[model samples]
Target: MTRGTTNPNRLRRVDRWMAWALGDLLRRSESAPVVVDLGYGASPVTVLELAGRLRAVREDVRLVGVEIDPERVARGEAVADPPRVEFALGGFEVPVPDGARPSVVRAFNVLRQYAEEDTPGAWARVVGRLAAGGVLVDGTCDEIGRLATWVDVWAAGSGTSRAGVGPGRGGVGPANAPVPHSLTLSWRLAGLETPSVIAERLPKVLIHRNVPGEGVHALMNALDRAWAVQAPLASYGARQRFVATARSLRDEGWPVLHGPARWRLGEISVAWEAVAPR
Candidate 1:
């Protein structure tokens, strides 16, 4: 059995990130989106809590808690809400009844124990099950869900155009247009020692690639240096120091995502290229 260590409100950070990043998608969907809380551990509290938060955005959101262990699934069923939220027995295959495909799958802290080589197969299994224009959030976080990182996967052959499209293609033609793909790396920065320390808990895909020559390694090193340069701001507090450090990195072309709003929360996100394996 997998370690089922979990706590109430432990996944708040990741949940909040989801709301901010995917809220538009949730609100725009014509039909209610089905969400899978994959591998929700021992208790169903996290699934229950996630349903509450997601429903705040979309009143019609449906949630399903899946566990590989049948006993765990039974336990989840015992605690789950009847229709809006349910429980099932399954692994990465993400078995769904009525031949339904989920719009979103939040698989947090599920693949940390697997061999690195097995990650792609596992990711493919879940991503393949997502509906068109759907998303698969594959991630790992601390037991309490304070620090988290996830990759948002989209189905192939989905919408290529972004929200806003300007007339007259200046930079590149349709064929040369860069594919719309991204990986978001989020960190809770309370006294973060080195970005590489996160390697210990990385979702199986990138854990072993945190070596010296990898893209993740370079990004972490850059973060460490930026943090060191902002040591003077530490007198204000770690939060302020983190914000300043992030701004510095951004000015230096680090692909930092947002401004003080996200920074104040001790979080930073960069494009997948920032940490993709070399």
Candidate 2:
């Protein structure tokens, strides 16, 4: 019942990241898990795009795009390739064939309508559907996919907490409650401005926390400062400026997770603690 406002390649940023970040997991799944694209909107292009990108990483990758609306599901099924890219009707249930759990449940923009406090329960539901070593990516993005952010959630001992980020250190919720392993920010660097623009599109949990006196707010401010100070590198292109800004944030005690390799792609990941709400 979520708004299905989607378009072709709208999720290209995250999909590209997945191809590199979780490609290995998909390759090693051994037929145990499927990749689910939850709530693919009115269009199935993104779903088709997901299959294309993921298949390049794992030729035999099993992929499914799920939506609570049966109409959308039917639409997706029309153009899907059988046995590989498929569509299903599901909500947070994250249904898969033969009761198979998913290795990665990518629920983007599906929870934007829910209350912030509802995130934990909804997240737990999605994570519960994950197979061993599974990951749930709860995220949001702009319509055209220019700016985006997502939180990576994993089961205990899955060792899926990656991109150089780990729990605690301010990333994990107090009392050791389940929290995001890493927070990722991505953008189309050409015609880019300051990095703080991503604050508007952060995952639901941190979206409202971008105001003054909030941890996420402070983090965005710091990034803006760093991005400004690194203006000299703009001559080399936004990529270099972004890489320098990332290094600056790290040097300032921010637990930035990804390195220049990712930063150069207009992406930066951070341990959740570095900006988790106080």
Candidate 3:
């Protein structure tokens, strides 16, 4: 288990991405969509914040805060409102009441503690419990949530797997692979220095892979170059500089996603294949 260290609003960058960038996913969910905060650490404040932010999109969204630590579960319980939000004892299993799967699982700062080889397994466990059109967002971030990144993973298919965990009735198909869609980077603009700072918090699968000859390394190097080339834009503020750099990434065929609207918020996302380890 982690140190259970957590602070209020230590996840704003990601939250904004989920609420706004991923709103389409939520909109597609049933009247009462469900979201899972897989490992919210010692506090439940972030969970509460998630409910508040998401309510703006899916008003009837349900939220669950899963924790392996019984004590942490108790902490979440103290603040939970049944039928809408609840706390439970679970690890990567991602157990939810009534055998229902989650539409979105945000397991930030959860897999870094395990061996790199274990990342795919952890992902499988979570993705196995996804609802239709669900997305498993596994990621890592700094203590105060300034710099953050995540991979949007979609489930692989139909059939039963993971100890009684089978796909929903008429689910996609039988499978056991995670199809990652994109890699997103976010930063708190105030103290921003260089975009490469996020290399320190890359997911387990890509963290060590960010070395010479790796696709991720090349991506970072490309980003740094674009950032440098856009130096004169700094006079307009870091936002403009970041937007120009992101534009360069897209122009160079780096497959960058999103646009200036998001870049202005100190965020940019790229297709996963563009940087997946070779």
Q: What number of backbone clashes does candidate 1 have, counting pairs of residues 3 or more apart or in separate chains?
A: 0
* Candidate 3 lDDT over residue span 96-131, tens digit each: 877778888899888888889998888877877788
- A best-first ranking of the candidates according to their TM-score comes to 2, 3, 1
Stretches off by above 4 angstroms in model 2 are 161-178
Could you estimate the TM-score for every candidate? 0.87, 0.92, 0.91
- Sorting all predicted structures by lDDT, with the top scorer first, yields 3, 2, 1
Give one digit per residue, the lDDT tens place, for model 1 in 106-195.
Answer: 988887788877776776678778765566777788777656777665555444223211112332223222222444455667667655
lDDT of each: 0.73, 0.81, 0.82
Query: 1 or 3, which is superior by lDDT?
Result: 3
Q: Whole-model lDDT, candidate 2?
A: 0.81
How would you encode candidate 2's per-residue C-alpha lDDT over 1-278 as one tens digit per residue?
77778967779989988888787677667773488998888888887888888888888777888988888989988988867888888889888766778888898998888899889888878877787667788899998899889988876556443333334244334332345687899988998887888888988888888888887898889999999999999999888898999999999999887688988889988877677776
